[model samples]
Target: MAERTSFSNEEYADILFYYGAARGNAEQARREYGEIFPNRRLPDARVFSRTFRRMRERGTVVRYQGDAGRPRLEVGDDEEEILNHFQIDPTLSTRMIARRMGRSQWKVWYTLHENDLHPYHYTPVQAIEEGDPFRRMQFCRFLLNADVEDRNYLKRILWTDESKFDKDGITNYHNAHYWSVRVMGNPHLKRQKGSQRRFNLNVWMGIIHNRLIGPHFLPQNLNGVEYESFLRNVFHELMEDMPLETRQNMIFMHDGCPAHFRLAVRSWLDQHFPDRWIGRGGPIPWPARSPDITPMDFFVWGRMKSLVYATDVPVPNIEDLRNRIINAAQEIQSELTDSRVVKTGVVRRARACNRNNGGHFENEL
Candidate 1:
């Protein structure tokens, strides 16, 4: 576009020349174009000095109040508070401090961003559980423990949990990738109707040195007889058949389920090499809903679900879904165990289970 010059448009001339020239520069963009800028604080004194000197003959830009205008940046009191908090503690990232303050990470980011605190090195990367401080601490603890423990611990310690999967359904957004998309709006998604053959699928999963060990799914309607049998079957498949050395070293740690806590189950556990089975953490006993202390609650399950949801496979049946889930779990372990993954320090915050007890989640609370 050609430059147009007239007394009426003379003031607007700097609008084009200034912005066009400032496609990139050390000088900051002015908050306003004309002499209308109150107080006339130069966006960049150096830029104004250079610009005015160059346009001395052309009269393209006039030196208004001997300075250029400040850009559209506005820093409120809240923004200043965040800036001060960040400046004092260089260790706390935008998301971390945001978590502490019970606020969105982007809110903190915006605070810094408006104050021109955004930079190359201090660039904000998207973090998970960005709003919860306790979870962040939990994630940090998991990393710390993993870093200290040997690879053998992760393997020997079998992490087991019961995941109920519908015959052909999607529970959350994560379950969609593992369900049958063939039927538009899958009807099997709801709870199985009366007298229906609802698959009471129960899986026992374990990991060994970044390798998934077992996931022996229990039979349908597994009662005491079936659960006991399933346990014995799992033992036969993993522990009973393995060499004495392998069975001796392999430690199984499972979540507290009603069936798992049954006296018969405890009897079975005691009978199977007595002290070998995981205890309820000594005499005091581990409390229910303490997911904050568990490794699986934060890292493993969430990562697996994330991967499962991301998968775009045509899950035809439960068999296919199981296979897909296993694959997702494997992928999570593979990605999580990699040296690069751990080094990245992607903390998966500790979660508070009791959200109803006056709801204490954020550090601020």
Candidate 2:
């Protein structure tokens, strides 16, 4: 195990004085502090600077009560009230909770842990409204009972969706954290919202078993006519690639977008897929706002987004963004699809949704 790295309150006091006396020269402060406390090695400049800055900001060199000064596990009506507040709304911040409960933030946090309560980050999900639970349950039950040729129905599913990728869409700094002696600041360049350089580009794609198809970038906004054209001009090619028997058994899956419900698109789907499809006006009513069950929404899009923006190389134009998306889609391997989509994950998700009585589940699609 590593040595205890946290400094004592006495050491913090000495460091604070030296940091000020040395006028923020971290190295000079460290050397001066070492002269006073010969037995203890001074922390690195980064740690020293962070601690010093924190002390100044908090207006104290002494540690917070629950974290460093003392471990306060004592509970009363106050602690119980804090826990109850959190139980009612888990999203309540400790600071906000402290303000409401007239208690220290640290004490409230400690009490929460004492009661085996911890704050979990909120997950982004499609908002489920009234009657969605029944729809979600029905969808899960269909998947659970679905069978084709004595095999699971998922084997024949062509899960498809459209996603928008922005040229300047950068990951959130809050979502990206550094685990070290001190928290590091984000260094990635920031882009302003609604800037011309930050324009969004849309792509349509489908996933079937171990195969990924068509990250076709839309040159214009997708409407009923464009969606119909895509189905005729692009989606047919997807069908042509598969064996005749596979095509016969396959079930097309898409969300209930306005374009998907348009008469022309519905006519085409009716003529081509007949009863073998999942969506509005088909055999199964795909649950509204439940992307957690779709491979494209939860897994494929996230994996591609992470890959597309991962590099430090600048995407100067829409073409560059398109190329990056295509490359990322190509990099999605068979084994990855086998593990994420073809395995028991999709079925397990349906079961989880069913268990929750059609309520929104934890993990994303």
Candidate 3:
């Protein structure tokens, strides 16, 4: 248990004000507070959160600790067993765990809370196959070495990916928020029936240096031939606008999709990019299931999606959706790409992955 410290009323107000001004993200507000008061110890995130909620409800910051006098259950053998079980499998619910342990659900819940144990939903990622880490390390080393020799090496590479967008399926799902005093629920979005098939569009795009090459909607499902066809139409166009130097030194990056490795696609890439492509059957193998280090996965697609679906106004049809995507693409600036995608994204993420031994990077919670 954290020791109870009595803070001045002024200090409490200041903390609340800082948190509100910085939005409701506790960590962000805490960071700002740290910058302002380097000498004073800021409260833990949970403490800050509880105080902020109280302020929101009462419109004032108070020093009273509501449950301070209540006796906390002592950590005994039973608590240790509960902690052990929870540590082994966080998916076990309080009620289920209590039943298993022959204890009350409230006791289990209290024990978990006292121990600072909270359940978090799993984040989805692609499953990595064997030898994926070695491939990732090798590819990152290749880029790092090339960058060491030529500073512009990263800028010369084209980052590409395909994503599906559903017009009706755009909401901040799984983004529920709960206040300390009240459960503040997300607004329900009434989804239309048969919405996904009717409204969804699969689009492909490529980013090289400052240029966003395509919001090209794949006419049908992608196959070896279709992917090759898209490349044939867009590859030359992507290269044509670049400088002679960049064009000569440029590399192409794509994931290890079967379509990408097919003979037709491989042959076309070989002709256009030669040994400068990164993927299966190419010069450098792109690691399987490694999206954290890819600019397309980590940056481009996410930014574009946020831009496209940010508006609450319903997209009328497929054409409007495509137009929205194109408009979003147009709004994407060169500086944004240069700063976010290439320098901070690819290279920085590469180094992070290498440090993690090719495992997934820890997400900022």
Candidate 4:
């Protein structure tokens, strides 16, 4: 006969500890047991009840050799049912499957592992409309062809976009930490509001090859007039530092945002960039809803936000927030000068988009 598997004395003590902590509730004890010892196989609710009863009546957790109880778990008995549930709904968590099947979570978990099943996170992607993919493909081909004509084509094109920075920036709870020597309430970050209104700063930035431009703060409610003023008055000044050769050869690119589609903006672009600009109705039409191909969207904004909000404390006011953004932009500018990071990424993404027929190609890259 095969030797029987049994719980160790320490395991018995832990069961009793959780049982008492849960006020003798067997189901709660089982849950607490699974949480406290995730790697161990979970005992059924009946096991908890029996263990507690034995502790009270016999004053010990050790079982006699002749004790008659439930038979050892046979995974074969429930493996098919567990796997069937997963086949029907792969999103169902182990806990949900265990509850539905009246089995311990560890049992379902073990069955999954034995069957070579593993969990994967779902990636969020942009929604491609009916014509979006075709447009994206066409633009990607244009970019690839331009690269062939001039190796420095991607490096010379200037990319620009506007993003909003909030006072209460994003927090990744998984990475956030607080250490204490004494017991206390959980520390929290305060999300401050000004007169019942959330505060945010709208700023514009541009990237050309290894150069950074214009951390210019824009009005909260941006419009065509305001956008044109920025382009005429502020944008030209920002580009003055660039080499005459680069400024002359640069192809200005912005997305199909409402402001960029205005007649005034288009006319301004036409006067300045003639047949070189990319936008809603410019010389080269930019694909709508195509952030995956834009350096400003795919790289610059995310990088700047991460740097700006990597703070030990919340930004006190708009001035401090603005300063932090400018500092972050300067830091990114210095980093870009050292490496061809943004240029390389743009070319790689354009190729990936072409390969995927422009239908969400981030995964391939």
lDDT of 4 by residue, 1-365 (tens): 24333588888888888988988677788998999899998986556666776778778665543334755445867987987787776656888889988999999887775444556443345566789989998998898899899999888889998888888885444422222111112223222222112348988999988888879999977788999999889998989999998988889999888988889999999998989999999899999888879888788888998998897678899899999999999998888866887778888998888887777777556
lDDT of 1 at 288: 40
**Which candidate leads in lDDT?**
4
lDDT of 1 by residue, 292-344 (tens): 33445445555655665564544567776687677876677567554333222
Worst 10-residue lDDT window, candidate 1: 175-184
Q: Is candidate 1 or candidate 3 better by lDDT?
A: 3
Model 3, position 20, has a per-residue lDDT of: 80
Scored by Cα lDDT, where does model 4 land?
0.78
lDDT of 2 by residue, 1-365 (tens): 11222677777777778877888777688888888778897665555665676666777544343555545555556865875676575556778878877878888767765443434334444667899999999988888777423455787898999888886655564532211121222222222222112347878888877778788776446788989998899877866777888788888999888778888988888888888888877767788778778888667888888889997666789878888888898888544645546436678888889988998665433
Q: Write the per-residue lDDT of candidate 3 for residues 198-271, one digit (tens) a residue.
A: 33788888887767777778854677888898888866775576788877887898988777889989888889
How many residue pairs of model 3 clash at the backbone?
A: 0
TM-scores of the candidates are 0.41, 0.63, 0.64, 0.66
Global lDDT of each model? 0.47, 0.71, 0.70, 0.78
Comparison by lDDT, 3 against 4, better one: 4
Off by over 4 Å in 3: 1-88, 92-111, 120-123, 168-199, 238-240, 312-316, 334-340, 362-365
Q: How does residue 86 of candidate 4 score in lDDT?
A: 72
Number of the top TM-score candidate = 4
